[model samples]
Target: MGEHSKALEYYEKSIKIKEISLPLAHPDLATFCSCIGGVYSKMGEYSKALEYYEKSLKIREKSRPSTPPDLATLYNNVGQLYGKMEEYSKALPFLEEALGIFGKSLPSTHINIKIVMNAIDRVKEKL
Candidate 1:
């Protein structure tokens, strides 16, 4: 519905404001990009979603999040989006990065570990 479009517009506005107010490399810009990406993903705009997600990743790489898992989560988001778009090959590395990070950062039995594992498995199945 229009609600999602409206939300996307609002997020875009917020991103513009943040860009003007914060440093060019600010992590909050990445957050806004991720939010917009998620909204685009939900709206089935895969290309636009990937665009914003990549922007977020670029910013995150520059900033280096407080936790490794934070970067992993972004990887996982991009990976999952690629998977959703049926680009299994593209999904593999990001999912692997996410898995590797989660493997190092969390306990073996952590749910995130399981989630990424399952996602990897699913992507592999598609491949």
Candidate 2:
């Protein structure tokens, strides 16, 4: 935790290794791409984050259905990143998707559903 840079460096290396060893369209590789995007987003690198997040989403969509928590998590993550970037318009769709997934998969009163609902509301206010 204290050495975030070092941690990210290792993650990047591992991601590259996965890319070389796995199929180009592998979901695991997509997950790694999403992790990279999240790291970049946390570092306040919006463009890089958006690029990788989109790549992850595309790969996941192609390989699996969109209802998995993995897909919802990515949607929420990218939406939150967009929210942080003040791109509220773009954030809504992702947040909405996350909300839908949780609503369908989890109980109505689940914490995750509430969290996504709040996120959607926040984005709506901004837009």
lDDT by residue (37-105, candidate 2, tens digit) is 888887778898899999999999988864887888899989998999999999999999998887788
lDDT of 1 by residue, 1-127 (tens): 5988999989989999999999877889998999899999999999999999999999998887555887788899999999999999999999999999998999999998899999999999989
Models, CA RMSD each? 1.4, 1.7
Top candidate by TM-score: 1
- lDDT of each prediction vs. the true structure? 0.92, 0.87
> Model 1 Cα displacement at 68 (Å)?
2.0
How many pairs of residues in model 1 come into backbone collision? Answer: 0
For candidate 2, list the clashing residue pairs, or say none.
none
Indicate the TM-score of model 1: 0.94
Deviation of model 1 at 12, angstroms: 0.7
Model 1 residue pairs with clashes? none
